[model samples]
Target: MSITRRTFALGLTALGLSACTNQVLRTAPRGAKPVAELPADLRPTPNPGYTDWVQGFKSRAAAQGITETTLTAAFRNAGYLPGVVDRDRNQVEFKRSLEDYLAIAASDERISKGRAAFARHRTTLNRLESTYGVEAEIICAIWGLESLYGERRGNVPVISATSTLAYDGRRGALFEKQLLAALQILQSGDITADRLTGSWAGAMGHTQFIPTSYQAFAVDYTGDGRRDIWSEDPTDALASTAAYLQKNGWTRGVTWGAEAGPGAPAGRIIQPQEGGPEFSVTRNFNVIKRYNNSDAYAIGVGHLSDRITGGGPLRGSFPPDAYGLTKDDRITLQQRLAAQGFDPGGADGVIGSKTRAAISDYQARNGLPVTGEPSRDLLRRLG
Candidate 1:
């Protein structure tokens, strides 16, 4: 996902990179944003179990070399965050087809923002590419997908979110490890606890690195002696991402892959969705999977990177869906719905809740069955 996949290898909501969210620009196509402010549910709440768990964890953290002073400061305001638990417990309910994934992952907003961000940060990105031997657009694509050009780096307190998830007893051991790594970051003085914010599941900064991943790979590209991915400047985060791909074995100058065609690169052919366009992926493609192990994610990053470099969208088209509707049909239905005074929310062809509501409202008024699903018959009727 790119839905709340904060570090899915920890098997959290999403981030090797795990899940995604609705906003996608915040991102996973899977795009999950940490809003302008934390919601009430995300704030701290009393939980005796969590308090007790923290005591034990503190002792264990000490055994693992965390200082008593660090623990004291780290936990001064840290506590259980129920919203973190809610987010951890809930995940993307359904699988998204490649087409739907692209619709969100490579949406117009993301593409446009990606190009502008590339130009805005061209110097830093180009410098990182030279240092790490990764493509600038690749780095920019990850930035777009991870935090939407630094606009949606989360605001949740890492200590509270990780500690709460750790004590929630679901992925306790794993998050406890993240909590421990976060403490180490704090101890290293890269950032203060007050400023250590990220997604609820612990993915931090512009690139959404989980604490452990941050520990293993983060870099201080600005040479300011700190990897400050959490700030408005994205130098360190982008370099760290480039470093990750290079260290993980990105073949220099090799194309990730592309929709198979006369111009396609030589590599293994994979079709992620049935009757969809075929892709030929290279070793570098697998390198991207190291960030978030989904074929869809890898494609989203790759395609979005190409688009940012001024390439076109995929020329191939996916077949009709189970609803016996092609994307064009859906667009037509939405246009027709809006024309009839029903709002289908501007015809992106996804047929979300608004489209369903419009369809149902129209159905009820016409004395038809209340099922809001689209069909060829529905399209004809809308006409």
Candidate 2:
């Protein structure tokens, strides 16, 4: 009943959805046109095998009650996305330390934007909370983590993505089921073929529900007779998320948890990153995990929810990283690299791919070995 991720890249990625192992990370934005609007690699490419696979799947789909008209319309525009295959094959579950994760997850920009989003949608969020017995901030936090408040809701067509993965055969069985469910969504007419876009893994909308999970938990708070999670309004998306948590045993009116400290309530004590802050989690926290079953993601959602509610950053300090560098040192390194136009992305203190690339570039430019690894000497050199 949930969609999850393997991507910190798609960032829809990471904590991938229910049975789909693909991450929900970054991808094309909403309303990208086929061929014309999409990047060349993402456009449908010629694949005889994929064509044959679709021929077989169409028979199965027809057996499953998908009308011939719906099949034609859905596949008329949908084609095998080579990029989705590339993303599926190349996804690596890199472990970002909680400190680094928080730097990106609850950064000033995300928190500020989250608070703004909270204000803008307070009425609807509160109404959903009342209706579903889930906290508004928790719902907002999931919204922030899932698609950056809908700004990055992916535009890859669901039919193509699911069908491609289904044909890829690595995870064919799961994708086949998802493919069926996606067809059902089309058949039901919640969204048209052209508009039924989602992440490369077929995770859709503000909260990134894959087709099966969408069928299981999506709600139409608008009551307009359609559960439209893809719309810019986000009412249905937020409501669907709230409904998910409520159904999954979210304890009404309880905090997901707090840093284990004074007045911290009794619950599970988990320190996902050793030497990082310890959290005393409540049932609500586990309910959050039912959305994305990762301690780090659950913490990201919880902590980001806290920050969105005007809470301060975590009071605990993490031990130095394996590189023997503190987060501050890493941040300083990234800032200096970015200042010189090496561009390590945001100075989030996460030595991610971009940061490593910047490090390698700086090293090469300065006649140093291009190890791309950071060291105190490198930090000092950056100085």
lDDT accuracy of residue 367 in candidate 2: 100
Q: Model 1, range 1-383, lDDT digits (tens) per residue?
A: 22223344333423222233234423322223343345788777889999999999999999999999999999998878988887767755346678877876788888999999999999988888889999999999998888788877777788999899889988787888889989999999999888888877788888889888888889998989898888778889899999889988998889899999989999999999999999999999999988877788899999999999999999999999899999889889999999999988667677666788889999999999999888999999888
Candidate 2, run of 10 with poorest lDDT: 15-24
All candidates: TM-score: 0.89, 0.94
lDDT of candidate 2 at residue 235, scale 0 to 100: 97
Off by over 4 Å in 2: 1-12, 15-24
Per-prediction backbone clash count: 33, 19
Best by TM-score: 2
TM-score of 1: 0.89
